[model samples]
Target chain A: MTTGFGLNNLPYGVFSTPGTAPRVGVRFGDQVLDLAAALNDPVFASPSLNPFMAQGRARWTEVRARIPAALENGPLHPLTGVHLHMPFEVADYVDFYASEEHATNLGRMFRPDSAPLLPNWKHLPVGYHGRAGTVVPSGTGIVRPSGQRKPPNQRTPDHGPSRRLDVEVEVGFVVGSPSPLGQPIPTSAFADHVFGVCLVNDWSARDIQAWEYVPLGPFLGKSFATSISPWIVPLDALTEARVPTPPQDPAPLPYLTDAEPWGLDLSLTLSLNGHALSHPPYASMYWSPAQMLAHMTVNGASVRTGDLYASGTVSGPDASQRGSFIELTWGGENPLKLHDGSTRTFLEDGDEVTITATAPGTNGEAISFGEVKGRILPIQ
Target chain B: MTTGFGLNNLPYGVFSTPGTAPRVGVRFGDQVLDLAAALNDPVFASPSLNPFMAQGRARWTEVRARIPAALENGPLHPLTGVHLHMPFEVADYVDFYASEEHATNLGRMFRPDSAPLLPNWKHLPVGYHGRAGTVVPSGTGIVRPSGQRKPPNQRTPDHGPSRRLDVEVEVGFVVGSPSPLGQPIPTSAFADHVFGVCLVNDWSARDIQAWEYVPLGPFLGKSFATSISPWIVPLDALTEARVPTPPQDPAPLPYLTDAEPWGLDLSLTLSLNGHALSHPPYASMYWSPAQMLAHMTVNGASVRTGDLYASGTVSGPDASQRGSFIELTWGGENPLKLHDGSTRTFLEDGDEVTITATAPGTNGEAISFGEVKGRILPIQ
Candidate 1:
């Protein structure tokens, strides 16, 4: 119940002082323990976690076991005096539509005359590749994107700043180890390749997405900026968070069947300005991250170090649990009343959004994923 | 012309000899000129073209000007004795629907009741990101991808090897300089950021793409393997190939309007098992590569040095100019007759597909893109 960065949970990140170069560090109780000076390993001195993560899981486990003792005497810096950088260089980014509630809500809003769920939704974890180069660290300023958008009532499309700017709360999985080409990684090997978890804010432009996402999926609407939490919470720290997923009705194909339960009982909170808007339950998601990885590589596609895959917006069964503003505001028909005596249908210029998550840790502490925060900047 | 590797076309590539690591080299006739030894710059000692390409356009021009003179008296090796590797490290891969004929053919085949062309086809270029990690070099064996597919007549989806494996003949534009985050690269700056052109074989599984591309676009269906030509023909070498793009019915938005005609008069030939099948004309494409790049970053998506964007299947009005097997065979209703009297609707096991291209060079000779060849391996 205290601070989430306790002795039981040490999340990794890259930080630097005013004039110093960025290097790997671990968050431990308001201070960053420098891994390079403590471990005497040059890999930790890298600006990104890719070099150490590429050393594979065995080395990761060995180094992680020694982190507690190293923290006792390592060079420590105050968290407030340090600047956080992107933890890893993103290789490829893929976002999946895994939430049944979110998908159903979107389906009903987008296609009122048809069934809520697409036929391929349950058969596979629907996903598409995103702009990896645009993946930024937390606190990056998000400029309001300008593109073509045609509302339902408009005959000709108009080009300008997006009117329906929004955010999607989701969990991100980071790949540490790589797999070979022409080889598919099975669902059971998910933990061996996936290094850790982080929080993601997939900013979206619904008006641009509505006009363009036909036959080829979302592009510029979701690619402008995707923000990620600076710290990465390793899977070892989440041993107490594993839970069984909900029963699947039509049973997935054999390749997607999980040998062990891979669900994490994490809770996410989305906030705008200073008010908490929603708390989406990760357990309510229909598909597991392991199944998503398995499905991604089922066609012999390889994975590389620093690859990031995100679970689509986490939405629960209730209206208050929706992760995206589109669902929360019901396609701009309904507006959310804020504590500051203002109502909002979509994000406005200068509006700031923050997403945070926590999971159960050993010794009854909570493992925090920190927060991914961004402010919408006016068009330049 | 003689071989494509003429003096006028000094295409850059990565190659290695026995027991030697890969390094940057340039093709001058049948010899591989070692740039590291020729230019005395260590950047050419890199295994990929990313390092040299990141030095910006001014540095690229300076280095390119010295290449022809250096080739006269530089250290060289026979091309036959060296092994060609992936020319550059891919940062992000995007595929664009720029061809009018190919889009119309697919639209007619996929949605028979509707108009052949979508409404947004003329207004904006339709594109989607593809897996960058799975992009392999030329001659890499492509494994048959297995995924879920459902024919219209089938009640339920089935999981197995794809029955409609296909290829897309396209031209790829490689980015040589990095752009700032939240900044849009204009259509006029196409040559300033883009380095060169190459051939790409976008191997796709038609069945899987058809089933899953409803709301999210292509994923596993096209992620298995994308083969690119080993050599990259720099833009400076193709001065004579510039032409005006086909007329637009509705004038594009102001941002997409090009200051200069960015169209390239490149002719592509597709061959199956050494038998020439189709001759797709890149000149007939509706949208230019500059327009694709302008629209891609108009929403403030940054592009990296090694980022690659490919023109979608180039097709002409004639049936013999179709770029994909699905179009040539008319969705399997008609089979293509091969030179050996073998009728084929889709790629078979051990089938080798090669795509090559040529553009007008400074001299009367043509500039060749070499070739991107891949053989289909049986499902492992």
Candidate 2:
């Protein structure tokens, strides 16, 4: 299979050279094409990719078509020694629990005696708003969050560093076109609003989450830091990855039903301390990105450019395909033996967790979604 | 009592004349002092207050001191006929269930089989991130949201316009100075980081919320539209209104405790269709703003300049002082008697709901918060 940044994969990001300001660039092969310098326009010179993202899908397509022709004679910058930043200014972050396998695994582990899934699990896409201010770019250090956590037998919660910190491997969708308030963008219009996709490491504090996520949803437990890959693989580049979603047991409502194949077949791999932990398949997710977006905006919530939504956890049916440590080790009852002769139920200080993924491309090639990696640091 | 905009209460907002661009202005009495035009500088010329808000407390104090002196000879425009937009660009919105009365009311109404209060209700200021894209300014017509709602007897949720619409009376705290990631801001540093407070109307669709908010939390039920007053009342102006929060039964942990009395005794009155409904008291909240801020950041989640956190449904002890229609009307078991002899279990199209509030000012006078009013429009 063909690999590397081929013609079919020109992911956009923000990068800067030594002593230079950040500008929008496209990754092609091992080089970066500076869009602002090539176009000789200041529109793409912003520190973040929000301006370029706000240009909408038509403009985006035009730029995509124009960039390759402009690069034939334009100056190219070496990809080495360049600092990459967050591609866009995140407006809001929404996380959806759309993976049936992951949700069932969590339900079974957390509530052993009760049903695996909630009553409304099959009817709608379950999601909640997340902290957008703490969305950092890839390579940012993950600080172990200290908060109140209650043991099962404890009367009161104790404040300390989280002992059950974990990583949730998922794919995130980025919104490019915004929708006005009181308008619901139908499932068929997903391509018009969504710009691209990226890999996300939703670092979670399971101890804090278990104690605090009652009545309301997760807050500080999952808000400390959410890391995303710098490169954004545009939706147009993933045409070959489209696949039909699994049939719903109970038919979805008319608003959520899409006539097209909305699922993208991608393979995600998670590693910790240079040891392969799991391979969560994104293709097995029960809900598609179109369905998730439709459910989110059906109630008239406006969508803004730079808004982000992530698949909760891309776990598969097998134990080795579990996306989080809680499911893999069954709530830390059984620890995982790493290749470095270390056992871990949760993340430890100095442990580097890396997640990488790839999707099907044209000409029997694969489109790479680089990597989102972060090393855990002791609580400050 | 000081009823009008006094010397101490100089609230800031963004407004524009018919022929000019939007700029930051300070509301004083019946006029607005154009800060940008008055200072002969364009620092405050941005459409949103984010740029000026990021200047930190020292610069804010400097501007506050200099604005009044310069206003003596500066251009003063009448407040009437000016288009008021959202004061600041919301970075992140968090809604806190800090009011004991509201939480207990909700618990008693929804979960009659269990305790009225959740086990973790008093342990921490329970909160969740809310949609920031739909946070509108006051007077913006609220389009009735349509979503799927499952009745108790129905096996599947049915799609339609929300039958049970309500509003949550709240006071929102706006952050001006941001904190670094991994660093928790102490309660004493609240004044240094938070700029002001504004009135918020957290619109809710009770039926939709009840159906979907099980495993996660409120999503579409509360994301439709959240309206805030145009003028932001600075914390410095509320010095005389400060009061001690109600004592906690199980005393909070050290991280959630504060030495200062951070509660402001604001009287919030809710009206539907020109008839009084309830009078929720802000002083009845069990948690203080400082304590809430501390708890939110103790887990290493960074705060941004435009981040906003609202005191969820400020209900008092009396049933007449309930903040939401579900509580005041007791889950619609009893319909509210309107001024025109019409009855209402929930809001109807063309019905205007207005929330006005005031706090104690210097010398026994009252500082007005200025009303946050919105008329309900039919779902599009």
By lDDT, the best candidate is 1
Please give me the DockQ of candidate 2 compared with the native complex: 0.88
State the lDDT of candidate 1 residue by residue for A199-298, as single tens digits: 9999999998888888789999999999999999988888899887778768999998987888889999999996899999999988999999999998
Instruction: For residue B340, give model 2's deviation from the true position in Å.
Output: 1.4
Q: How do all models score by TM-score?
A: 0.99, 0.98
DockQ each candidate and list the results: 0.86, 0.88
Q: What is the interface RMSD of candidate 2, in Å?
A: 0.7
Tens-place lDDT digits, model 1, residues B212-281? 8878899999999999999999888888999999998799999999889989999999999998999999
Off by over 4 Å in 1: none
Model 1 lDDT at residue A368: 84
**Candidate 2, residue A42: CA error in Å?**
2.6
Task: Please give the CA lDDT of all the candidate structures.
Answer: 0.93, 0.90
Tell me the spans in candidate 2 whose CA falls farther than 4 Å from its real position: none
Q: What interface RMSD does every candidate have?
A: 0.8, 0.7
How accurate locally is residue B250 in candidate 2, as Cα lDDT from 0 to 100? 86
Which prediction has the highest TM-score against the true structure?
1
